[model samples]
Target: MAKLLARAGVASRREVERMIAEGRVALDGVVLDTPATILQSLNGVTVDGEPVAAPAAARLFLYHKPPGLLVTERDPGGRKTIYDQLPDDLPRLVPVGRLDLNTEGLLLMTTDGELKRQLELPATGVERAYRARAYGPITQEQLEELIHGVEIEGIRYGSINANLERRTGANVWIEMILTEGKNREVRRVLEYLGLKVSRLIRTRYGPFLLGDLAVGEIGEVKQHDVVSFRKDPTRKGGGEAPKLVEKPRPQQRGMQQIPSAPKAPIPKPQPARRITKTSANRADKAAFAEPTRQAQPGRDPVVLTKATKVKRFYDAKPKAGTGAGTEPVAPRAIAPGQRPKVFSPELGRNVRAKPGRTATPTEAAERKPAKATPRTAGKARAAPSKPARVKIHKSRTRK
Candidate 1:
């Protein structure tokens, strides 16, 4: 019954249990007095004579509780409570846990009572931290002993980690962390050590920090952060844990740290040789030098390489009247002191013969001057020279 009312957003599970014990809860017109009554739904249930509304989306707030403000809705002594300090437009909210009037710092408030119950349960193992300004002659060893928690008035505290900061004139700042938040835990613990606590500020609750939030001010945790905290609220600050960032690996202690990427080896520098203008000119001349050759005839009269193959290639082509058809005739290679043959048009053939052979008179006689064909026999007559310039003599007989 209590859980159902809480799930319905009537109040936190613990608060609902308290209300049931007070006979303020009823089911189907019957006043209920026990939280153990199990019910399927809140179809006709009433809490404090009012219908319970359906559950709402989870919302959370981080409030910086200032000293002297009670963390309650009402105080019998007419003292100021946390609700009076909140904005009027704020939604109905319940503190996740109590921060006594004298204690100040981070106090988580939420609209989802179930979430409040989840976070406040000691089984969740959420850590809470407080920095106490105490006047005492405390030592590090004395504080470390609190790891094995101490008991006062027959009530035992769970393990706590306490550390002492610097001291000035018997006034010291001490930091203590504990998973459970028993009432007046920090003050009583310090007082047991003969130290008078001047102030008690809870600097951390679960995973949330007090940070720079001013006194009596409130801020909200983002929805995603609240969801993450509800998923695993067992961390320090009772909320999302601080992101664990990897620290860059530093130089190894004993052995030097190895470089991730190999360093490029630098090339050795060479001594530059100094070259004079005279030496430079000599080198340029040598690089461009040509071996002198004896001059050959039928070759360029100037400085040029002889192109013997080019002339041979063209000469190898068959003459137009060659009887060999289109077959290219291999040119007879003319050596030094040798001459190429000529074509004999009168003979109607090329008369190239053996090298060093002299032609006989009969053969020479065989070569005759070519006779013109009819097409070529008739010569075109030049324009007849203008009729010889004739100046008629004037025959004026004694005129």
Candidate 2:
């Protein structure tokens, strides 16, 4: 066999197995039953009833994927896939790193399956940087612990560099850099420490950045840059064959070399105060005591009487100028024919008439109504004469 399918670039040794299972691939007018079943170059091979063509050269691109997109070839639940957001002009590409459905950031995609494998393998050691906003009280000490390592649900996670960027109220923002991409590692670690991850965004993946790349945008890495990245010493061998370094575990005090457990913190004793017998007796009496005065029948309630007295006391005096319970009194009304002893203006001023004072007949006669002026009298007489004359003239003219 010439490895005819592989020569045609239809798929790799692994994908051919999957294609055979799907029944879309056939050989010599018969569908292939298994990947191991090989044939000579003369055997007819077809995909979707059409002859397969050789694949073009591989290409790589950097995509800024927004949240709510699934990083999969197809989702069984009919969820929107990253493929749906890819431009129509783009070739079929596999994501180098996966961003969860709720995660948004830099995602690398490649047309060649071999390149995808190379980038995703642990050997890549590609450092992924993320900016995370967490809600809870986080201290610099906690961030330093993250740099060492953290155990989550019995799974031991490796060291990661985390820094506290800023704190606002109960929420904090942190910048984290990790080489190994674990599933929900950042979120899980923070949650284990009683913190809530409110937002997560990948700012950079290796050398590629998400800067200014709008959501759903796909950008191709320059050919020269791709070549340079492949040769980068930092990403050399694609995280494969990482050098192992032995870490010294803390020693135990016993003769045997047993792993020592963290020591339990020593608690400090609080101060004890001595209480006197008199003070205790007074407190007991106060707690059990009742009011000394008993209620009287037909009397206002004690609370009501107290409230009424307070209201009256406040109302009688000006709030600030006069002292309480010492307001000035207003004068009382006087009865008729009883002269007030002291005639204050507010009481009512009195004007007494002089004795034997009478007006004479001449004086009384002089107070007559003043006569109307000649102009006024003339106008009054002329008003009635004009109406009478007009009526008489009309009767004469008619006769």
Give all candidates' CA lDDT scores.
Answer: 0.80, 0.72
Please list all clashing residue pairs in model 2, or write none if there are none: 122-239, 123-238, 123-239, 123-240, 124-238, 124-239, 125-239
Model 1: per-residue Cα lDDT over 180-227, one tens digit each: 878888888899999999888888878788787777677777778888
Q: What lDDT is obtained when candidate 2 is compared to the true structure?
A: 0.72
Predicted structure 1: lDDT: 0.80
Q: Model 1: residues >4 Å from true position, as ranges? A: 12-35, 46-51, 236-399
Which parts of model 2 have CA positions greater than 4 angstroms off? 1-15, 26-32, 36-46, 233-399
**Candidate 1 RMSD to the real structure:** 30.3
Q: For residues 1-399, what per-residue lDDT tens digits would candidate 2 score against the true structure?
A: 224454345655466677778887877688777767656453467887997665555667778788899998789999999887776655666677788888888888877666666676667777788988999887888888887888888898878899999998889999988887889988888888788998899987777667677766677766666666767725532221111122234557765865889999999897986889998999899989995876897794656433444456546645563465666655777677655554445448754433455789888788766787756644645545443333457447321
